[model samples]
Target: MNHRGVEFTVAKTAIPGIWQWQFRIGEETKTGKTETKIDLLAIRRVQLRIDRELKAIGQRTGPEPESGGMVAGENA
Candidate 1:
């Protein structure tokens, strides 16, 4: 799934009822596990996490860049 300017995936782990998810940003990547069997729930959790990260840097909390000067992380 793609959200908050990054493409990520949620997959079932070998554990009885755990899901693994990950997403990558420039020069950074994050991964985590959720104890939910539902794929959409896992995706939503990751989206919330991404929102937290973007909010920390004053970046727009959404996918796709706005019509402006530069993107979130870029050489300017």
Candidate 2:
């Protein structure tokens, strides 16, 4: 399933009520298992997880400099 540019898949594990989900963004792949029987809820959970990860990824990379000048925290 695809939501907000994120694509993921959900499958039921052998343990019964466990749902496994995985998604890929750029070169990063994330996977997890949740204790939910509903597919919709699984998707929603993955979407929320995606949102949080994307935010964290953005924060980690930060923004690029426009003028090719010295980057932040760089020594002269």
**Residue-wise lDDT of candidate 2 within 43-74, one digit each (tens)?**
78888999998888889999866897887899
Alpha-carbon lDDT of model 2: 0.88
Give the alpha carbon lDDT tens digit for every residue of 3-63 in model 1.
8678888899999669988988777899889998677787889999888876765655455
User: In candidate 2, where is summed lDDT lowest over 10 consecutive residues?
Assistant: 63-72
Off by over 4 Å in 2: 63-76
Error of 1 at 45 (Å): 0.4
Query: What ranges in model 1 sit over 4 Å off?
Result: 59-76
Q: In order, what is each prediction's RMSD in angstroms?
A: 9.1, 4.8
TM-score of each: 0.69, 0.74
